[model samples]
Target chain A: MTRAELLADDPLWLILIKAVVLLLIGPLMTMFMVIFERKVVAWMQHRPGPNRVGPWGLLQSIADAIKLPFKEQIIPTTADRKVYFLAPIVSVIPSFLAFSVIPFGPQVSIFGEQTVLQLVDLPVGALVILACSSLGVYGIVLAGWASGSAYPLLGGLRSAAQVISYEIAMGLSIVGVILYSHSLSTGDIVDAQRDGWYFYLLIPSFVIYLISMVGETNRAPFDLPEAESELVGGFHTEYSSMKFAMFFLAEYTNMVIVSMFATTLFLGGYMAPWPISLIGDNYLNTGWWPVLWFMGKTMLLLFVFVWLRGTLPRMRYDQFMRLGWKVLVPVSLVWIVVIAGIRAFRNEPNISTSQILVFGGVALLVLIAVAMLIPDKRARAEDEYLVPVTGGGHPVPPLDLEVPKPPKRRSLSEAKVARKPAAVPAGQSTSDTPDKESE
Target chain B: MSAVLAAAAAEVSTGEAIAFWVLGPVALAGALGMIFARNAVHSALWLVLTMLSLGVMYMVQQAPFLGFVQIIVYTGAVMMLFLFVLMLVGRDSSDSVVEVLRGQRLWATVLGIGIAGLIVGAVSRSLTDVPVENLQQQNAGGANVNNLGKSIFTEYLFPFELTSALLITAAMGAMVLGYLNRHEKGMKRTQKELVEARFRGEYERPSPLPGPGVFATANSVATPALLPDGSVAPESLSRLIDSTASETFSDEIKSVAGTEPGPDAHALTPSTKDTSTTDTKNTEDTEETR
Candidate 1:
């Protein structure tokens, strides 16, 4: 049966069940992701993680969640109480919302009722996820603003900028996928990758998206908002106990959402790996099997997130932003154009094999030439504007650049006479005479 | 109008309507308390009440998600930050309001009236155009996370991505702004200098000769003589003179001191003839007595 026929047959109760399942999956996956990340990072760093909780600390997150609500709630005196209280809710809701459109499996029979293994699907499902994630920034921003503290506000602002920058690169990176699939629907995009994953065909876009997704989620190595050394817990600095826990939960859930999106778009959502696909006609691709495969791919992507967090240090805020705008955005844009060109050529009915090879060769050459040429312009511009000044008499000091030596201090007599009284007490005479003779 | 009034009356009982009336006033009180509380910290607490009431309103509107978000984000995290900043900056209860209204009281009144008028007009217009079908269809479940997610990832993907870019830029801008550079220009000056420069301007110069020796005499008579014990006796004498001179010198010095050189002028010149005569006379008297 066609995909449409299968979708049309789904009952209201089945849809509700799928939605509930999806909702539960987000928190559950987030819990596991947290524990898994800690354990893996600990392993990488040569330490044990969370072995005290139930069964090798598998239930640590559960313990945390249980403990959170009971902890004392502190409201900052200078904070906007309404906005401050609303920020974390804004954060977690969007995370859950973003996860809803992600397809977990193919149409599966449940309680003898046929239904898609998703809460609901829309033609613009991908855009919905993006919107939710974008809306998530308001929570951080408002939290910072409401807190009325410098650190939280700074963190909030950083989070906002981080999300906005990486989001563009992230979106651009997906343009290639959208072009290839010819649909914005997550399920359709996954279905389009049946023959081959876009990760292989659109390698640059895939790589760009992968990098941008990490930055977008404010994960480790990109979590400037929560840079402990700098922001003292970022936008949630004032948050205590349950409110803080919600933010933490929201962050992990967001990570899962992004990973699932990456899996659906580029890793072929719910499709079994190559070896498994080769073993049988359709054993692993049907029923509950596909769910396992889908989950496995998402977990793997999540593991990569943990690995990055463990291994890489957080980038400086400027460096993180520069990577998004200066590198990822341009690369994604170029790749999109290249993919579009290739797709147009592929669509031609009478295209020859030799002509295709020649076109491919030319495309590769053009890409190389463009890549080689682009940096020179940037370098020249940077060289020309080498002076590190912000220009309000408060110039940004040059990064790692040596400032010219200030004119040497004049001899004592020539030094400008300070107009104010000496900082030393008036009773203590400033005469240069030594008391040694009297002594 | 009669049918509508009858329907409204039928929908809510007197008790329910009374409860609504009570809640409306309470919510308004909470909002006013949030704004007008003397202590900033108290203001935040009052705001918490306001948010809680708003959340109830959201619940009434069948927007549980929005209501939950309202409480969680606004009351929980944002207010906590506000309180934290107040504490961190040491804003005590004793801190006086620096400027209650400044010059904006009239402007504020005008703006408030304008806003109230606009809101009333809008509410009247909205009441006239209220659609029963739209109100009935409002519970269509599109506001759920699932629907929201689908919409974001599909139709609004570009704008969503663009918004992320905007947020990232804003974050970057904030980081740049918040970066506390200890060595930033103008901040390098001493605290005293900064305060003086900021408040005093150039008005606080010291007098050129500020201390005791500037106008005082350098005479040997004024100077205390060292005794055989190596102690100076003249400090006590000067203290005695200082105590007596203010009262005694006013009448006597005014008449007699006008003829003689002034104390300051006499103190400056050398007393050659008087010193020599006094010394010779002292030696002659000692020889005669012996």
Candidate 2:
């Protein structure tokens, strides 16, 4: 059957089943992502993770979820009650909505009806994911704001700024993928990569996307929003119980979604690996087998997330933003141009391999020459510019400690003269008179 | 007008229309409560209620994204910042109303009414001109993320980028403004210190000793005259003068005794005193001759 026929053939009941499956998969995947991230990070660090729950601590996430609602709910006195209540729901829903566009597996027969293994697909499915992720920022911003505390507000602001910054790079990074596939639909993009994954061809875009995804999801190393060492749980500082749990669930779900998206866009979604694909069509790329391939690739990316969290310390907010705007966005833009050039050349049927080689060699030469010629821009000297001391008038002397001179002391007689006279004077004694006479 | 009205009526649900009828006044009341509540915190709560009602209105209009964003951004973040600032500054509830119009309540009211009139006029004009066709189209598919994305990246790309620049500018502006306010406070403290230093430099010391002849006259007045038989008076006039002079000197010394001398100054004081005594004698002799 054609793609359209396969998509349209799903009846109402089948669609309902798909939707339920998609919805259930989100929370379940998020739970596993949480457990897997912990276990993998623990393994990397030579320690045991979540071994107490059901086998290998897999049930720990479930227990935590169950316990969440029973925990105390705290409504800050200064918080806007309605907004506080709505923020977590705002955060979690967008993540689920973004996941809805993700295609899990190939067309499968469910209840004797052939349908694609997805809740729904849009022609602009890739853009929908981006939009949903963008919308997720409102949750973090609101969560920070509704906490009605300094740290949370700062965290919210940082998250908002971080999202806005990284999102540009994230979107720009995907431009190469879109150019290569000649399609914005996630499924179409995945299908176009049947010959070769974009990760092999557009390595820079993949790297940029990988880094941006970490920042976009506010995960560790890029997790300035919830840097407990700095922001004290970041935007959701005051959120408690199920609300807090929802934020946690939203974060993990986002990680899963982004990793899944990465797999689909760059690493060929649900496609059998190189070795597995070579084995033959009978063994792999089948109904249930493709799901395993997709999950395996996505889990590898999730492991990268865990590895980053274990290895790298969280970046300062400004540093995170600088990397996004200064490094990632610029590099992604250049990479997009190069990818576009390659696509344009490839579209020419008469283009020879030598011509491609010549173009590649020239590009490499120009990159090397530019790298060699460009001067390194170091941070400006400490005294180059005076930072206007805010809130107080004097420019805050940069934190180089210079001991101040001690205050000069006055003579005792001079100090005594400065004191105000007492209201009542002591009566003069005859002894005082004789002492005065002797003086 | 009738056709447009009918179209609008068709778009709204009967249940929603009922909800609108009920909630419209309730929302207005909440807005009024926000304006009139004595406590700033209470007013913020009322504003939250107003925002919630507005969210419901958006939901009724089938714009769930806008409804949620409104609640999450404005009511959540913006209002929270307002409350945080208010709390941090410690604005007194009782004083807030009085402070709002310290000198020109009338002008404030007039300006407020004028702005309200302008908004009402603009909104009414825009409402009449809104393309009903677009509303129908928007209502059909709902405001899904895909449509929003397409519109943003394609048609509104420039505006979207501009909005991002505006946000960056705002963040930087807030940091600068906060920094400046803190700097001004520090300047004020330094100014106070300068003023105190000037006051200290202007301080003058009063003289402690009178001339030698004046002391002698004072002593003679305090002493009794010698008896004609060459016996001393029961009370000595010289003694009286000396005692009075010494008592006055001690009182003057006590009055000026509080200056804590430096260690070096304390060490040199006795030597300095001997030199000053010799100088005082020479000065006294010159003054007596003059």
Candidate 3:
């Protein structure tokens, strides 16, 4: 269908229905994803996860959802009542809004009226997703600040920095896609990918986008905000019951949004896979089948997210920030330039495949040369703290160190034989232990 | 279907009118709230609301690109930075009363009012020409993003380039401001003095409140301890519950009063009042002398 045809207005009831479906789709997908994540992670770890809830624990998320409302809702006495109450709400709204622009399939007939499977498709569909995801940060930051607690505040601050660092890369990465598609609308971008996907054409942008979307959602490896072993529960430290559940829903829903966004941009969106499309002259890419393909691609991305969460360790706050700012941002920025140049070259008359190949080769060499040029970072023994020791502590754990083991069990007389004190066991250095050891 | 859609597009929808009224006031009220909110964080949040409402208003006006950018850049990133600054500076820090630049605030007010008047005049004149109805058609819509970009880069290239230069200059100015080091009033101390100040013996890492490990009380953070040395005391105000023991915080001290030799069966005191009093007075005097 043409762009004008795609922009056709549906009946008001149909529009409302689309919105309601979009709303319901997020929570349902979140519920499914939660179970899927748990099951997959458990399988990877060799354990049975929540099987008691239902058959193979398929309905565990539902049970959790049911439990959330009945549980006692807690608002800390010291918390800023209004901000605290609004924080989770702020987080969840954008996640739901993000789902609006994600194209599920092409136009379909519903109740004798034609409408697109997606909700609204604004001109800046991809940017809307980026915008919504960016807005989600406010919820986290506010939640942390309003908690009137220490760890949550730290978590919120981390989120602020995290979002700022990753979003530039995320936006830049999308620019490459937009340059290729020559359209900002998600539907148009998907439609353009019908002949050949941008996934292969814009490989670097896709990879950067993959990393960025992970960071954007604050998922594993890049999930510094709620680094459980460090900041307690991060921004949701003071939250409990339904309010806390909202944050949980927001997180999983963002995962879905980013994954769907990736599909829309790089994975040919609702188009069937190559093997399937090749059959019957691309028959499978039509009607409700497209929705299935779109969902399948999104699901695959979600699995990748889950897989990364299961496998990789959470990144240290500084390392995560450095990766985003010093690496991903600059790389994505450079990649956009490279893509734009390539586009300009392709547009020129009489350019051969060999010339394009040579250009790609040169680009690859340049990246490699740059990589080799930058000096390797040597580990610093002194600056080992995850976060720096700043004025007025915010309750983030300092650092883990190779503390000399305590002395072996011995008689009091044997212990007393050495001049070293009981507190300073044998083979342990006094100064090596951090102040936290005193606690 | 086409006819119905065309008719719907021609007439102003109730939803559109409602959204305009709803969002316009909220955006204006958000500005007012930003100025009046007591807490710094609350003020920042109000600014966020203003930016968000404006973004919504832009979307309502059919400028999706501008609307999303407004939300993403101004509300999302810039407001976040403002909050970061507020949080970092200590959340409880209030605005200073004393105007550092004399007459600057007054000049700023006057200039702001003059600018406001100019904008109002321009908008009012435009409104008279468009009659509000044609302004809807003047939307140019989401597709205008490409047109706008093309115009700026081609037709208005010089002005756009000038704007970029101005932005670069502003950025440099900000960097320079950051680079400038302002000296504080505190006199620099020697390494030895600094070390001495930091490592205060028996009071290392003082907590802001009375909490666990201060003294061996059953209830960790609650209640102050009374010393056996005839002192109603905690030696340090710090409540940081460290592994190290206090001189007074020992299990062997028995009870503060030796009148009851319950746990250890160790310090048997005289049942008679006179003898007990003498013994306690002698111990107190000895402690004082030491």
Candidate 4:
């Protein structure tokens, strides 16, 4: 029987237990993720990290969990109290909800009752994750808006734009996977990858998914919305205590969700590695062992998240937007067309697999050539101004960047004279210039 | 669409009926709350509640794809853009109730009622007269999405393609409308112009403002710097911080400085006096007197 069929037969007590377990997974993952990120980042930077809390800072998240609620909750006087209180709850709920469709392992026996290790697998399970992610942005935007402050408002707007821009590319990338798997259900997609993962088959889609996922999650390198240097803690600037902790929990939980999703889609969910699968006619792929493999794959992707944070600096907002719209979106469109062409060719009995691959290669090369031939509108527009592009057609900063001149130095005698009551008029004239200039 | 609704209605479980009854009133309340909310953000949020309940209703009717798309497209993207624009322009810039166009409110009320009656009449007519098919049987193997895709591509291909073209045109129109001609607007200022303006003495303070100093009370950016004589350096406090900060410290400055200086008493800089020495001397002077 299919996984969905098995899921439908689950007893009420078993379903409740599964739901409870799924809910617990988010917080537990978040708890581990928080300390994991700090420890890994600290190791990368050659720092000791939070070792004092417990064994290699294992209990640090627990300490934080204890401390957060007791801290003072300061609601800003100007804030819309209802929305302000509602924002964090809005942020956290959908994050956990997105995890419902992420299949952990194949059908497992829980107290001798057969069930898939997932909360519920809707027919359109993949879109549920997409929907939840889309809903996630509202919390941020609302928090920023309800704060009644300029910085938070700006932060919120940036996040809205960022999520919208990246989500298109993300959805398109997922379409490639869905096309290959021929199903929108996460379980079916995983089941289809018994022989080969979609990542190897659709490299462009994989790469685009990687870039867009990072952008979608608001992680470092694309983390402009919550850029601490610019936004002063971004949307959560006004939030304090448990309210602030909720947004924190949401972010880490989102990281886990996206990582699990990427694993399920690209890395082959709950399936053992090739060598291991080969042993005893896929012995390791069966029973509870698949869960370990699934967790291992998820952790691997999570490490990539941390690795990216440790390695790359945050991108400029415009540069990030250009990457999303100009680069990723167009490439995804072309890739989708190519994939459709291949699928069409595969359906024709006369065309052999080898010949189809050759045809696909030629099509890809032709597409790349066409892409290269297209002149850049932005560059051409810049060229019209006839600004000297000194660094090989790249716009360079001005050679002689001017610095403001320093004020005329006052001697000790002049300063002493200025301090005298008689020199009050002279001091007034000197000070007046700066004040006037400032205006 | 009606076939899908008919199939869902045919099943009519007790739980499904309960959910529909509960959500119907909630959705109505949400819509009413949206109209009545004082704040624009609150209104938008209320609308979101309405949209979410509608999405849940769609799910309950065995159309998960439509439900998710409703959340993703309407509540997620469209409403977010609404909130974005509202926040960007001005959150507090609520619409004035004073009608610029006379009889606008009366006409709006009449038209709203007319539209409501028309929708109700059309829906009830369709419900009674339309032939219904079982979508559950068609989608027995959980092939609802696949079946929808097949219909869109096969039977309704031209309409689907036309809709995409319309959407692309709308996007292009938005891009064209938003495009700014920087040259025509003269919004782009060269570095040369700024530097020349500074050299021409158009600005009084050619350099950036001095950093906040080590005052006895605080050394934060909001705290104004202390000069050698313990008076506040007017240029040292950031204008942004100055406007929002409650403590101007005029009384504190008077006590610290001993004698209050004139309005423009900020010209006591000596090239020879180190800031650390001056700060220490000021502190010691205050301590000795105390």
Q: Candidate 2 lDDT, tens digit per residue, A211-260?
A: 99999999889888888998778898899999999998899888989999
Which CAPRI level is candidate 4? acceptable
> DockQ numbers for every candidate?
0.03, 0.02, 0.25, 0.26
* Sequence-dependent TM-score of model 2: 0.59
Compose the digit string of candidate 4's lDDT tens values, residues B145-224: 99889989999999999999999999999999998876454576466444444544556744556888765777677776
Whole-model Cα lDDT per candidate?
0.71, 0.73, 0.80, 0.84
Cα lDDT tens digits for candidate 3, A1-439: 5543544567778878888999998899989998999999999999998798779888899998999878998889989999999999999999998887888998778898777887776667888888999899899999999998899999999999998989998988999988888888898899999788989988989999999999988889888889899999999989999899999999999999999999999999999999999888888877789999999999999999999999999888878888988998888887888787877888988999898898789988999999999998974537433243345633333244345667577889876786555567666655633332333
Those runs of model 4 whose alpha carbons end farther than 4 Å from true positions after fitting are: A353-439, B1-11, B97-113, B189-290
TM-score: model 1 vs. ground truth: 0.56
Q: Pick the candidate with the highest lDDT.
A: 4
lDDT of 2 by residue, B76-157 (tens): 4566556555445433435535555565888888999999999999999888986544244553332243465678899999
Interface RMSD for each of the candidates: 18.5, 17.4, 14.7, 11.3
What ordering of candidates by lDDT runs from best to worst?
A: 4, 3, 2, 1
Residue range B1-290, candidate 1, lDDT tens digits: 11112233325645446546766777888899978887675676577667767765654444444555565556544655565565445434466556587767678889999999999999998879865332223323222334545678998999999999998999899999998765467466654334433333233431121222211455433344544344433332355445436434544543443332334535645664344434444444554455
Runs off by more than 4 Å, candidate 2: A349-351, A356-439, B1-290
lDDT of 3 by residue, B164-209 (tens): 9999999999999877343334656644334434433323542333
